[model samples]
Target: MTHILLVDDEPHIIGLLERALRADGLEPVSAEDGESALQLLDERDIALVVLDVGLPGIDGFDVLRRIRAGGSTVPVIMLTARSGTADTVEALDAGASDYVPKPFVVAELLARIRSRLRESAGASTVLTYDGVTLDMLARRATVEGHDIDLSAREFALAEQFLRHPGEVLTRETLLKQVWELDFDPGSNVVDVYVRYLRGKVGASRIATVRGEGYRWEA
Candidate 1:
């Protein structure tokens, strides 16, 4: 599982962010102060960092500096209340991948996180699961060496399932990531796309998790 380091002193914010990250298939490790945040960076193989600038100690800029100086290229997103131009410039200069201000919309923040991850995922243009393959760069799908035709949305849905095989992905998560819809549209779009993907991949390739959502068979 990919781990995300969340550094914030606010308990409420931490709790909220943790749940949000988990729902998106990320494991979040929390630290309330800058020292612990730095410690976590050393202790865990974190895929990314969502850091607060107003930390109790060491501060986020210092932590970001240390991370970059230590030769760690791990992506960092500064999450802070400060929206000043100088503050944003400093965070970016110190090696932050992105910055999100407080009172942020959860969907927007998630979108930024996904965008940063995509930028960092260099040259990863293909995804395969159980002989089903998705060519991300080419926008193509294939099953067992046979080419399969899929719509744009169908390909995105299949790519998500292939990336996280065996993990039960909620309809909400699918809708958010694949369609960029933060709330359910009161429609069966996810199920409809899943059926389209299964037709091209195979019927048994994806498992419906009853009321939960769907899971790509491992």
Candidate 2:
């Protein structure tokens, strides 16, 4: 059984998520604070973590940092009431596999969780295009044999482009495939991340189609 650690101080939220996760065939382990969450991680074989940013102590960011510091690559989805670009970037920069703002729809969160788990369980395959390489199993990206540091989201975005080289991937398609968002959120998130990828992968590699979307140049 896949055990998911739910770290939130709110009992109602935990109960809500527990019911939802259980209904989706996943076991839920609850933790009210960061300390307990870390202990549970150590004692149990947890596959994923749904961590709340605000906790009694040790906070979600600290917990995520500790998890990464311990060299554990377990998928962590940060849940926070604070919905800001800074907070989102902070969570991703801290090695969070995904971020869900509080008051989020349970169904959407579930979709994101499943997406992350599927990516985590992806088969070992090396994708090479031009001078870039992506190790699917290791979730590593390299350019010209040099390692490129990428966040979980960035890596996922890169995978989509590599998988369909020369295909113009619309923003809607990228959002659905990469962020698991089925609807347009009216945000520039796709463009923002594409710029990030261009800076690392090469500007000319991804061509922006005016009135359309983006295409990976083959």
Stretches of candidate 1 off by over 4 Å are 123-218
| Per-residue lDDT value at 112 in model 2 | 87
Which residue pairs overlap in candidate 1's backbone?
none
Best candidate, TM-score: 2
Model 2: lDDT of residue 56: 94
Write candidate 1's Cα lDDT for 1-218 as tens digits: 88989999999999998999999998999999888888988898888899999999789999888887676668788988876768876876576767788989988988888877776676357888799888764556788989998865787688788878999999999976665545565879888989988888888989999989999998
Q: Tell me how far the alpha carbon of residue 41 in candidate 2 is from the true structure, in angstroms, after superposition.
A: 3.2
Q: How accurate is candidate 1 locally (lDDT)?
A: 0.83
**118 in model 1: Cα distance from truth in Å?**
1.7
lDDT of 2: 0.89
Span of ten consecutive residues with least summed lDDT in model 2: 176-185
Best by lDDT: 2
What's the lDDT for all of these models? 0.83, 0.89
Per-candidate TM equals 0.56, 0.70
